[model samples]
Target: RKQLVYSSCRAESAGKALADVMPDETVHNILLTASLCMGFSAFSYEFMPTGDARRFNYIAMAMTGFCTIGYVSMYNGVGVIEVRGHDVFWMRYLDWAVSTETFLLGLAMLSGADRWDTIFILAMDAIGVLCALVGALIPAVVAPAYLLGAVVFAAYNYRLFGTMQVSADRMGAAVSAKYKRLTTQSMAAWCVYPVVYLFCEMTRALDETTEVALYACCDVIAKCVCCFLLLSQP
Candidate 1:
């Protein structure tokens, strides 16, 4: 259903064009990542009132907490390796920063998420469409910066799933493999924002938001309808 909307709206075509032009698979990954991430986000906001920045933040923190626990447990089982005192402090600081950032982003989204603006919302939707188009049309050289931006900005998602492991206590090997797959997939999701942002910037670079806007409007209607249903629900 999501892919249908993406395709019917012509985003897939754009992506194909971008993919054709760029030889790198990273471009395609970034393109798909952006579409999936932003599409999920737009869908959630549109259809599920409970889905918002707050939910995103909560999920982020939960993942991070689990990863931290997993890391600690694994270290204990392995017998602690001694680190210089300064290194310990640095690692502790990094952990603190990751946890705090997760909490804060959630808090920020929850406490003061702006009223859903149609233009901005549509603009967000446009991001994926543009990425698809650019990736297909432009040189691969354009991908790295967007990749970097995604890494810098959405880096928190990485820590959230970083330390997850399959435990022998309960799940079978199949379950463990599935969990590992999920963790890796989650890590991939962390890059979606950079792809979307980069794609939008690329289109904006070409002064082509006008065409992108058309594709974006299809998503806009879907989102607005979702928002309406959410409002109508008791």
Candidate 2:
């Protein structure tokens, strides 16, 4: 009876936590489910940071940090309530490592190590964790599509980085133009991904019945835009 009661209480608490974060009662399920999907989508790209040019490198790092923090907060509050003592220690370490890695990656970039560094690995790990949590929580409705996008995005970043690295050898205005275009396009491309994420959350909060559809549409649109932005550079 005591165990049953404890489980019931935990369930109640979890529901409350979910309610608190959700923007509206009507679309609570959608928001919760969407966040879970997004989280899982994010986890898959956590480890492909290799070969990113400076701009892409920085964006990858930022994405990882955002996804990690978002997942930790969402998971701890809404998904896992009865975490065991041993797991608690690991969770603490996970949190610390993610936070520390994010911080270090930022500091390294700002201090000018963006060209080459191992911070990429740390950022990727954080992203992986975020994706895993999403996989664990969200309904698998649109997960496969999201995962495809992530894989494509990672590959795009890799190829872009390779092109930039080779372009460094060019002389005169070509070099400058390549760098300028890359910087501008990458900045523009990355900004859209986060905006799409925020839009999905906001749409859920607004209690829209089309929240999932809208998010999927927006995500596809955003990916297209990012691709265009990247292409515009070369």
Give the number of the best model, judged by lDDT.
2
Worst 10 residues of 1 by lDDT: 80-89
Local distance difference test values of all predictions, in order = 0.35, 0.41
**Which candidate comes out best when scored by TM-score?**
2
Deviating ranges (above 4 Å) for candidate 1: 1-154, 166-172, 189-192, 206-234
lDDT by residue (tens digit), candidate 2, 50-131: 3444454444444444534544453444322222110111232254345435433433342233344434534553554354
Per-residue lDDT of model 1, residues 1-234, tens digit only: 998897777977866654443313432343333334334544444333443334653444343443244223322322112222100112222332343334333322322323332223223323433433334344453475444434434333333223223131134664345444443443343334344334444434322333224323332332222222223322
TM-score of each: 0.24, 0.29
Candidate 2 TM-score, C-alpha based: 0.29
Worst 10-residue lDDT window for candidate 2 reads 81-90
